[model samples]
Target: MSANEVFLVAMLIIFSLPWLVWRLCRTDYFAPLVVVQIVMGILLGPGVLGRWFPDYHAWVFAPPVVQALNGLALWAVMLFVMIAGTELDLGQAWRHRRESGITAGLALGVPLLLGCAAAGVLLHLPGWVGEAAQGWQFVLGIGMACAVTALPILILLMEKLQLLRQPLGQRILRYASLDDIAVWGLLALILMDWNRVGRQALFLAGFALAAWGFRRLMVRLPEADRWHVALIWLALCGFTADWAGLHYMVGAFLAGAVLEAAWFDQARLDQLRHHVLLVLMPVFFLSTGLRTGWSVGGGEVFAAAALLLGATVAGKLLGVHLAGRVLGWPACEAPIIGWLLQTKALIMIIFANILLDRQIITSASFTALLLMAVASTMLTTPMVAPRLANRRAP
Candidate 1:
């Protein structure tokens, strides 16, 4: 809105981008780009001085600035998600599909079901109040949130550890990626239900068909001309989707899925990824870091926050374990898949923001849920997949 506000926002990005890149370039260990940006965000936010200097935070990470920075980040995120969707090869797992399907179902369905039940129980706790905080509402939201499997994180870590090329890595990544897409579809459905709109499902189905049709048409276009205006179209779609009551993410994500280069065109896909990953995605992750107000923690809020954290971790472990056995996830693959699919990331930030927006969940609850998500992701995803591979091997 004002020149000073605009200047502060730019400074945040300028500081964060290089900090993360430097960390990522120096060593692959502690600092992949996302983790670095997250750290940068913490240092820059209320977590540190925003904690120490309350007035500085109020003056700096203002509501308008947060919105503006996050808005800039959205495109990069959509690009990343789209690249993820496009990279999926249903055929890779088609042979193993039957077994992997069982593993994936346990990974997805079990967590989802259990997450809901966990929420139901948690919400009824005495004196708890929330937006979508009632029995069924709470249950369903937690279940799906617990069910979330972070595909991008999985791929990033796998690549970093050189696990992507391994058999276990391949099986896990392929299955996780496909299942991630499926889960997003389910999330979209939950949103439709949340909005009390039955027609959105049909609208999405039609959107899928249209994407397929457009993708088919794009293949016939001259190579350079095909991708030239793709980002423009996607941004336009994102704005339209947001205005239409469906989250901008639905359109943004689906646009990525639709425009993605298919299986045979690996080179083009790789080139496309270079642009989205190094450029856009970092912006998105950094923006997310900036948007989170770590300084908002309060006393009563912490207990509820703690409950959310506990529920999140316990829900995923139990949910995934239950489905792992029932779906016949090869004992090794099942537990591993359970952990992999259970990791949550920025999605919780969105959910927490939704609660915050409605004044349902306290700022502390938002902080706690986000912490739960990050902690769960860091703890579960990094170690579980590789270890499972070792155990499963003959």
Candidate 2:
């Protein structure tokens, strides 16, 4: 076949595989959607087909197209945030916020500190990527990766356990939402620091705080569909962060915090998610898989990926167990909550991709981290859900 035809066909399959897998699995394999999408991309891209058909990844998931696909990812991320907001029952979150926050606190804090310490070590190793990875940037990348959670997977689990509307679920959801926002803001600052793309630590913090104040003042103007307001604000937020040399996701996330503060509705949130979930988000995933570059092969990369997998297992479970009691959760449920909350695949992959593309980290490092995230999600999901099946709310 002609090279252009090869490229066109590869693009078509990579983009369509997620929905196709969903259909093929009869939607049974829906929970681990990100993993499915990524694996399929690997099969189709440089991992397998791309090795033979090099024209595909270059033509399809290239800069211009990936940039366009990012808009959809941004939209999904925003809608996901809004849904998180609607799911937040203030009474429940406030009642449990102290403990809920405590849980979030431990989960994030440990990763931040440990990842920072681990950075020096992870940096010395060869990266899956070709770039010259540094000390603090290595630290920042791992720390941010440590702090993230995958909301799509979390939502699916909530639905499966019938925990979407329950008091426990509401509390967990609110805190998770808050945790996500905090992590993104911190990550933006970290990325800026690593790349020297913009201001350093103090400046980014001040900018974010000032921006928060400005946002609080502006969002006070209520709109008919707060979700739509959120969509516009999300785009603007991401654009702002991008302008500031931070990843656009940073801006989208902050805009979401403002949206949550507005008191949105479940129905509207659902509508927003439906709008972005199918084609846009799937395209984003495909693009991410293209970047994942399963072609990376080496012993050091494999070892580091294994370590990350172990950390995801031990660190997340321990973090959850530590904070479960304060939230009024029983022993039986605490472990489940810990596992499910730590499942990090899609969002981590997206965040990791930004760092890789910017040359802040090596592709191999990204690959290991991707492997870690996928392993964590798989390990956590089955352990958490089935155990809590009996305790599931109606």
Candidate 3:
């Protein structure tokens, strides 16, 4: 088949298979359609599909086809990340600063320390650290990956559980929002190149001046034009950041972070986020899967995943539980909040992807991190549902 035909075939598989499994199998209770899409991506990757059906995999994901998909995936994730940044509600977090700070601090810090230890263990072994990474970069990258709370995914899960507008749900959002900022900040640090320090500094200074003008212009524009301008801003920031030695994803997040959520209609913002997820993000997931490898051995990769999963869940819970004690939150609230905050699907994957792209972590490490992310996300609903049900039953 021609490259176009094969690309279409790949696209068909990317969209259709996940939906079929999600619908026919009725996995929504434990695994949402997004989760299934990620899992499906893994299965269709070189590790599984290529291993089992090399010729077919090669034909379908030919160089041209893969390139086309990657182009789509890059734009898709940038839009998604920008939406996440735009939706951060830092005003709310500031209003509840004391509580938000405490929870976000522990929720991120504890897992980070534990994950660093886990990284230390991996450092002793081969095939885990990337070739270009310094020791500290590898350790901190893994640590932050554990600490991530996928704010977007958390919002989705809370919406699913019918808690999105509840007081508790809003509280969770505040905590996650602060952590999201910290996560991105740390990512920028990890991706820092001493050789390009001057360039990065210049990018930040220029970005600040540009952002001020951009915001001034945005508020004056009609809503219809704001959307077009936002995309232009996204493209420009992404390009400038990539050129400055920071990853384009970092720039994407910053571009959105500076914008006010109130500038856009809430419903419209939600629709934009939803449509991006529905239409574009599946390609990103598949591209992510293609990057996963098990050169360190499948057993070792799974073991590393399990290790990271334990550290992530345990550290998040322990940290939140500690915060509950200090903040005088009810006993039951800690576990439910902990499980919910531990959701790490899209954001963690994005974090690990940047690390891999920068060569701060190997594909083997990426595979392990990917597996850990999927498992942690799947655990969120199941773990939180029973606790929520019991709380409401009385």
Q: Candidates' TM-scores?
A: 0.77, 0.80, 0.99
Candidate 2 vs candidate 3: the TM-score winner is: 3
Number of backbone collisions per candidate:
4, 4, 0
In the range 187-304, model 1's lDDT, one tens digit per residue, is 5554554453645655566676767777777778776666665666577556756655566666776776666555236677667777666665555555555544534345544554
On a 0 to 100 scale, what is the lDDT of residue 140 in model 2?
A: 74
Q: Give per-model CA RMSD.
A: 4.4, 4.2, 0.7
Model 3 regions lying over 4 Å from their true place: none
Tens-digit lDDT string for candidate 2 (1-394): 5555554564577567665786678643334565676666545545556677677556655566666556555566655544543443445556667776798887766656665555557766554433644566667778778767777667776776677778677666766766676777676655664555444444457657866775575567555654455566666666666766676666655555544543555565666665565545666666555565444475666677677666655666677777775556687777776676777877788778778866877766777777777777767656866777766555
Q: Rank the candidates by lDDT, best first.
A: 3, 2, 1
**Which number leads on lDDT?**
3
Candidate lDDT values, in order: 0.60, 0.64, 0.95
Q: Clashes in model 2: which pairs?
A: 128-364, 129-363, 129-364, 237-251
Instruction: Give the per-residue lDDT digits (tens) of candidate 3, residues 81-160.
Output: 99999989898999889999999999999999999999999998999999999999999999999999998899899999
What lDDT is obtained when candidate 1 is compared to the true structure? 0.60
